[model samples]
Target chain A: MPLIDEILDLAGYRREDLYVCLGCKICSSICVLNEIGIEANPRNFIINLIMEKEELRRDPLLKYCTGCYACTFFCPWEIKVPDMVRAARAALLPSHPFEQAFSSSLELFGRVYEPYLLFRLLPYFFRKGYLRLLVKGLPSFRLSLPKRVKTEGIFDREKK
Target chain B: MRYAYYPGCSLKGSAKGLDEGVKKVFSALGDELVEIPDWNCCGAFEFGEKERILALSQANIRKGREVSSEIIAPCPACLKNLREAADSSVSVLHPLEVFSEASFWDRLPMKRDLGGRPFTPYYGCILLRPREFALRVRDPMEEIITRLGGKVVSSQVKAQCCGGNLFFKELEVSERLAKKVWEGASGDIVTFCPLCHLVLKTFSEKGRRVFYLTDLILYVMGEREFL
Candidate 1:
């Protein structure tokens, strides 16, 4: 049991951290996404996670997070919204191709890479009316090389 | 003061000005910055596994440890990632602390007139948040700006996220958020983190220039053209 707790603790976003959520919704209201018209109801999501609702794991609204910890900063319980999002995102990654592609770029190049990000998200970028961005990034190979900083896997332990 | 420098991937590329600005500012302050030999990427992927990011950051910490006991990460994302992996053995610092240091105050020449309105100081999303990992220098940019004969332009989006993580993933939505940040800001937007700088600098229209807090330090020290 002690070892399991350590593994969970080390693996990030411990279950014990979720137990402190008081459902105050301070995180929800203070969320910067709300200002942008995205209803990032982080409180409900955390509550759903605590309740073990499988449906919340598939919620598309979860993808709207900017990874901004404004909610965590304002949360009374100190529950990290970004960590909770990360936990949810781990399960949600397969369904979210854009996110999955971006993470794959990180695994490959290790930066918030531009070229591959453009290549992978071409259709999405076109649909999003950002072809201008793709065309601009098209000419910039000089910028892409710096994104590939190899992070050698020193800590090889993997969570079961 | 001397520390190991981790010019995270963003600072190496799009935010290169910040990297140069930090070096110049530190040199001006008489602090020595040594780049960590073979420092790996401090993970900035929002959807990346927490363990993976921590492991990646830990690798950089090990590299940083080879250089100095204290590590300086100029970008807020890098600062957060490195500090998350760093234990009591190594201290991670951001450039904001330099503003609070007595050395900065003592060495600063008389306030140079940049001839401007109140500069809209942007701290971005995480530069001073999540409490435990944030830099201690609160409102330091405002003080520095005021001391340098500039006013602090108060805006609702001053500390908001500049659509940083979304800029890459959700482009239109990122633009909407960036639009809010640019609109909410006054004349020129002054930012602390590289992502905020990247998002704002590239997205801002009408020639509304974006300056990293370090760039402002360089400007006050008299290098007019940084773009």
Candidate 2:
């Protein structure tokens, strides 16, 4: 429960947001569960949370969320179901190995390379052809970097 | 009119055409986009996750507040994130929506050479799902396309996701998704999101051209004398 509070604190969302949610099942029905083949019944999870069902919070169903946000799109009430599930999973990360690994990788990728490569050098590399040639020569170094990184000027800015 | 502009990571990088076109189109309509200073990475991928909202969205908002006006975002993901972060408190409008509102659509000069081709309005995932904004773009886009002697084909796949997010994580899924959108349509895809342009262009096996909405605008603007 303390972990739940921590998640809530981090999310800055109130329980009232969840309470406003009506279990209409729109989210589950529209979900791409058939493609992913994972149980992502957002309505059921919300209901369980409302009932204080601690076991539901511990269920493996939370792992299936791709954060695609199909649920939030269809919600008539605009209830933030994905946010709720993310918070719940955040609280249980200690026991959730898969989630822990994923989070760790994300944080690690963001830290080690994103600052220098993505935020800084990538832009310079795109602008200066020599830098791109240099990086290309070092294939191993480039291959080791995160896939999401982008070079600045990949998008053209307005001319001054 | 002037507003704070958050072009997002993609606009600064791979989607330069979008940034250039939007600025040109809006400037022609007497609108100004003041880029926010000292902006940080938008946590582009993680904002939707509850754990990252405060760090991601709030940080953008705090920077946005420095501008003292509603933020006009060129990227749909950035707009969506900022909208979610502001709790809809501030008006987070797409540059196209702004241009359309300023009656820029009415002032659009006709196209000279359409090549008799139709362009599908590719809404991408974020922009299309938000029905209000999608509808807003449709009318203006239609008017512009029609004037260019080009047809605007309405396709279901137009609003589909371009697999931009999945591309890096799952190449197979990305290729399949891109093919779905490409194969599902009959003509070239026109998009507002740069990620969609890059993804569609990469996966297009038939050499289908994906035009950004801004690119089309610039093209039309270039041909204004013909109109």
lDDT of each: 0.72, 0.60
- Flag clash pairs in model 1: none
DockQ of each: 0.40, 0.12
Tens-place lDDT digits, model 1, residues A29-54: 88877887777788887776666676
Candidate 1 on B1-227: residue-level lDDT in tens? Answer: 78899988667665677788888888877889999876766657553357777788888888888889989888888888888889888999888886688678788654465565678988887787778888777788887787777778865677777777877667767878888888888889888777776667667787687777776777778865542
Assess every candidate by TM-score.
0.86, 0.69
Give candidate 1 misplaced runs (Cα > 4 Å): A1-11, A58-61, A95-127, A131-151, A154-160, B109-111, B225-227
Backbone clashes, each candidate: 0, 8
Worst 10-residue lDDT window for candidate 1 chain A reads A134-143
For every model in order, the fraction of real contacts preserved is 0.42, 0.05
* Candidate 2 share of real interface contacts: 0.05
lDDT of 2 by residue, A7-92 (tens): 55545666676788777889888765434445568888777776667766655446545445667778897665656666666566
RMSD of each: 3.9, 8.7
Candidate number with greatest TM-score: 1
